[model samples]
Target: MKTDADAAPLPMLYRLYTAGAQIASPILDRMARKKLQRAGVSKARLHERAGVASQERPLGKLLWIHAVSVGETLSILDVIKELRQQAPRMTVLLTTTTTTSAELASKRLPEGCIHQFAPLDTPAATKRFLDHWQPDLVTFVESEIWPHQIASVHDAEIPLALINARLSEKSLMSWGKRADLARALFGRFSLVLCQTDPVRDGLRAFVQEPWKVVTSGDLKKSSDPLPVNDLQKARLAQAIAERPFWLASSTHAGEEEAMSAAHKHFVAQHADGLMILLPRHPERGPEIADMLRTEGWRVAMRSKDEAIAPDTQIYLADTLGETGLFYSLSTLVFIGGSFVPVGGHNPYEPAHMGCAILHGPLYANFAQAYADMAEQEASMEVADAAALGQALCALWGDDEVALLQANAKFYIEASRNIRKDVAGHLLALIAP
Candidate 1:
């Protein structure tokens, strides 16, 4: 009856449980495909044979980075770039959970890094993946701690670290249920680089050695500004054309309706105002457009290459990996997903883009960053949809609000070097 955390291998019953879980995932996958369409990601099988072939090529020391999604991948991109520059001969293995993450990582990864799908938590798959990659040092971005994967790395006698790690209250509560198991799994890591004091405190509660966790600030703060080519900037500028525009970027399900309402409110005041809605998930684009259209707003979906005409009320930024475009074009930006209990999307991107910022009240995920911005008057928090509309209207009507925009610009400018600070800390941990 040994639990997964016990050093002893997962037991037969646990194996059956894991197998059942894997089988159940396909049913969820089918449902996701029906409900989410293009946003649904199928589980990827590890290319064990190909991985083994690459391992046999006599590559030098391998450093493996596992990032779950686009955010995590982008968060650690600077660190990866820095690590490569410092150790030119070191081979890097990048693993991601989703196909979108993998695709984005593939496009952005430097010359020496190889991208692969991380294996499922099943023992056999984990073992196969570990056997092929033979990573010398393993670092996970954020909190994607897989029990079997950590155990497999420990079994392989490889060093492990968790960088930019943060645990939500809900997640911490779930782990508290199996504290002993959590401790055992987390104890295998040589270091846990936490993002903030709260994250460090949470990890300390579950780990055997409290000092193993270090606070290094969130890596999201340090990410290089999203690249905007000159052509794209000009095109976006031409499309926007001095229209008072506010971007609701990385919006979640409940937030879109709120944004649509806010857009209508702004339109009432400034007839030339634009509301650019970037849903967090691309699949939600069509659905959101339909909803907005139903509300009598003229909608232009980005995927359809529709231009934002003078009368277009809402521009649906429905594509992937182009949030930068929307953020840059925006005079003011609202970080979405906070209106409901979805935690919130990253505000740093828009802040860094020098746009006046607004977000909903629920931003526990980026609490520290948001607190700093709020204190500095670099960002504003709205209580509900009504406040959201009010904030947008005020910013659109007044030219003096540009002072608040300047504060946001200054905040981002001053903090851009956080990546260098974090990269230095991470390298010392891994290579030292």
Candidate 2:
């Protein structure tokens, strides 16, 4: 619940933000349309960015969820499923801002859910969206703060919540400078189910009541294992029969070079071992493949359908939506973005598939999750390419890999109820 404080006038900074958004709406709408077109969104769908619905909102109690992009969208899938099971009469509208996420939603969202491109953060666009959907409850996943959107929801007297709410230190410092605006924007949320205690504590500073920010567990932990294409997995398994291999997934710029050096060490030990390089951005496939070739590694680019020949040292899996297939095939996995300054990709993804997880020192974004996994001996952190190679070489044995996989799976099994609890909280927020 919203209190008198939440109902107060918007702060000066928030007013300025809303005013600026209103003034820039037209230009922003045009830019969003152009981006959608470039992303291959049809002319009919382009209007979605302007809060024009592509399909009629389903009748009955509708719960609307807004996720910023792919990661956030994936994180909430289980929650939506849980909500559907518990509230069979309710229809869920899942809105995301990226075309890739929309495509994923088309394939993955549960039966009761509807997917849409989120409106541009402008007064008119948000107003149109809310007026059309008239969601009974609204949720914003993970730091998607738009002043116009929040104010419009509050003005509509809707109960809004922030689930899996995470706040980075950088974001805190930035918002901390404008306490009034922060309060105005954040206080409107009826509840905040935080992923971490630090984020909950930090957000309490901006909310009307400290009790509103509860430290609920990360919903991603409860997400189902990444989807796999059985046909593709089987084909790859046949092609890679009886060969030692490990994956270096979601890698970044400098991390690829490090992994290449590690692969050199790997091949020196097991001549037939394959190193699968899955970059965070797949468009860099050609560049990474070229770099590997220059370094004397025979690279097979997945996008080009290059076969993993007997002599192929690095199989660059640069295509999208195949992470699950690779993880299913490899027991030893190095989750990248940690070797570089990037705060690391999700270790849970690999862990859920029972892949023994490895990473570098820099994973502050997932510090708590990593710490928990480390305590259970579910994950290992390597300092550099040499250490990564050594760790992989050591973990190649069946017993070593099995232990890590068991511990990681145990961690996942223990957290199975987090999303259920979150779903309960969200359901409670629905209007009576």
Candidate 3:
């Protein structure tokens, strides 16, 4: 069972990368502090970015899992719960790189799991983190390929796995260009559970052993539907009973204007049509509201406790961890981050809640997932505001939305084995 950590000589690129990281540690730490501050890390907790733990590590075999953001974080919560079920004495340490993900982790991470801000990928920071935590196994989510941290964990002889692994077309090409570096990094992993067969094929070329990379299916598809607050769902359902409303969810900066234009088109025929705008970042609620107001739209802010009045054309759901509630409220959902080049948000969230899904064309990150949905006619794609408006108008018809939703349910059921397979592989990796 010897891996790169045991038998392979360090690739020349790997040697240079670790050495460069060592030399750049001081500068990287300072830069990380500035970036963390801007991401809303408090002054007291800033050192967490430098690999300093704010709380004491628990005594026992620890499984360290790193997921870079909210989507990645959510994909693994159920996995953590599964892990705890099999190994009650094993504690899990989850690390993330963003404030929103940290917030989500605080509210949703299962028992026996703790969250921390991940260390910067520099030699000093990774060393500090590894020395303090001393995890028995480590796992990374998606495309988090930090050389220093991976190398540190490997050098410490911790079993490392990359679960729900994927690389965009662009990233795969980039890695292909640097074969040595890719091998050096990918070789260290004891296993790589890819999101799709294509991802496994794309990653296999770089790994020293083909068995290390296997397709386990997309974890997002297998994740539990976004949790809803029943009380809140009931209250909101009562407030907007029988209204024709759609949700523009997890929208980025540039996509909001497109959403606004589409909403305008929807209301032209049905004047009472409502658009629930949920931006990706909750902090930008005020800015989004102001912009919509200037466009002559009546906007009601969720964070402000404003009621969804009859005159309110756009209800701004700018709160955190309530997407499930919003998803439940709408029949047709336009998942944002697609109109722009953010590779789109997870469509699984909306699909699981029985919402007919729509998105723009830039979904390379979730290519297979989107393609599978499109094949089943479970999701629709729009190129811009005009196309979005047309789709919205068409999908609002009861018959049209129901067909898409039925297809979406079919896609979900077909993929039900994904989580079980992923959990089984992870359980094997983390087994003592």
Give all candidates' CA lDDT scores.
0.76, 0.89, 0.86
lDDT of 1 at 408: 84
lDDT of 2 by residue, 272-336 (tens): 99999999999999999888899888889999999988888889999998999999988899999
Per residue, candidate 1 scores C-alpha lDDT tens digits across 1-432 of: 111233333445445656774666445434433432354433233243112222342367888888988889999888888888877788788887666786798689998888776655655556666776777788888889877677667766777888898888788888788676777678777788888887888878876678878788888877778877668778878988878888888888788888877877887888888888888898888899999998888899989999888888888989887888777777778888789888887877887778888889998889888998889988888998888888888877587468778888887777666667665655565543
Off by over 4 Å in 3: 1-8, 31-46
Report the C-alpha lDDT of model 3 over 66-91, residue by residue, as the tens digit: 99998798888888877888788888
- The top-ranked prediction according to lDDT is 2
The order by descending lDDT is 2, 3, 1
**lDDT, model 3, position 153:** 80
As a TM-score, model 3 comes out at: 0.92
**Candidate 1: lDDT of 68?**
83
Query: Could you tell me the lDDT of residue 85 within candidate 3?
Result: 81
Query: Positional deviation of 268 in candidate 2, in angstroms?
Result: 2.0
Looking at model 1, the pairs that clash are: none
Clash number by candidate, in order: 0, 0, 0
